[model samples]
Target: MDLEPIWLSIKLAMITTVILLFVGIPVAYWLSRKQSILKLVAEAIITMPLVLPPSVLGFYLLLAFSPNNGFGKWLHQHFSLQLVFSFPGLILASIIYSLPFMISPVKAAFSHLPRSMAEASYMMGKSKTQTFYRVLLPNIKASVFTAAVLTFAHTLGEFGVVLMIGGNIPGETKVASIAIYDAVEMMDYHSANSYALILFAITFIIVISVFVINRNAVKSPFE
Candidate 1:
């Protein structure tokens, strides 16, 4: 069995999870703070991927990043960056597709937190930034972990969006999910089953961990 595809999927998931951790915290924090028309709009956009078809997102991204189009053409001419059907393109699409997974749980955690926490931190002369990082984030660590794990797991099984944007480029965009599809297409059930079993085991473990984490979080006195 070629483990390259599995390794590639793991690499992509790790990178995507890490990036979402940093990016999601700030966005989730902002979204949790208040309710407004603009916030609603932003939240809707962020959460759209949860329901949006991966192929649709992939198609738009493909057009946006295609060298034949304006945005892609500009990037190609100015910086010689090509995203479509490339590894970088896969990373970008994954990030967008998985944004809500990283943000929703963290935002829920943040919203459930007491206002007194931030207020007390402010009274102590801590900057909003400092308070958010030090006081609030510590309390929501479990949620953050859940979000990260969910994002990692989601990215690991990505198929439609990745296939549309990255296609199958061995050792590049040929992740485990795509490899499974190719194997099935060629009637190589052994390889396909191997990939499926591995992915199923990995995702199952990750999901179980999330449930355990959430259960513990709910039982924690601090929560």
Candidate 2:
């Protein structure tokens, strides 16, 4: 079995998860506190990828990232970056596709927090950034972990978006999901099973780990 795809999938998921953590955390924080219609619209747009058919998302991304389009042309001209059929392109697609998995959990965690916590911090003369770092983040550590794990697992299993944007180029865009499909198409069930089992095991471990951590987080000291 070619281990390259498995390695690529791990690499993609890790990068996407890291990027999402940085980007999603702030958005989740804002969405949890804001009461504007714009926030609602933005949340809807972020969650749209979750609801939309993967093929539709993939098609739009394909056009948006293609060299012929305006956005793609500008990216090419300014940054000399070609997103189509590249590793960074796959990572970008995975980030967009799995964003809700990261955002929703963190948002829920933030929403569940008491408003008084922030107010109390402010009363003590803590700035917004200080309150977020010293209080809010500490209380929501579990949720942050949950978001990262879920995003990573979801990206590991991604097919439609990666296939549409990545074109299954080996060692660059050929992640495990695409590799498994390729193996099946070529009637290589043995190799396919190996990749499938590895993927399943990794995902199962992550999910189980999340649940264990969540359970511990919710446990009472007295209990």
Best candidate, TM-score: 2
lDDT of 2: 0.95
The Cα error of candidate 1 at residue 187, in Å, is 0.7
lDDT of 2 at 172: 89
Output the TM-score of candidate 1: 0.96
Candidate 2 similarity to native, TM-score: 0.98
TM-score per candidate, chains pooled = 0.96, 0.98
Q: 1-223 in candidate 1: lDDT tens per residue?
A: 9999999999999999999998999999999997999999999999998898889888888999899998889999999999998898899899999999999999999999999999999999999999998999999999999999999999999999999999999999999999999999999999999999999999999989989888987795866
Instruction: List ranges where model 1 is wrong by over 4 Å.
Output: 220-223
- Tell me which residue pairs clash in candidate 1: none
List the candidate 2 regions with Cα displacement exceeding 4 Å.
Answer: none
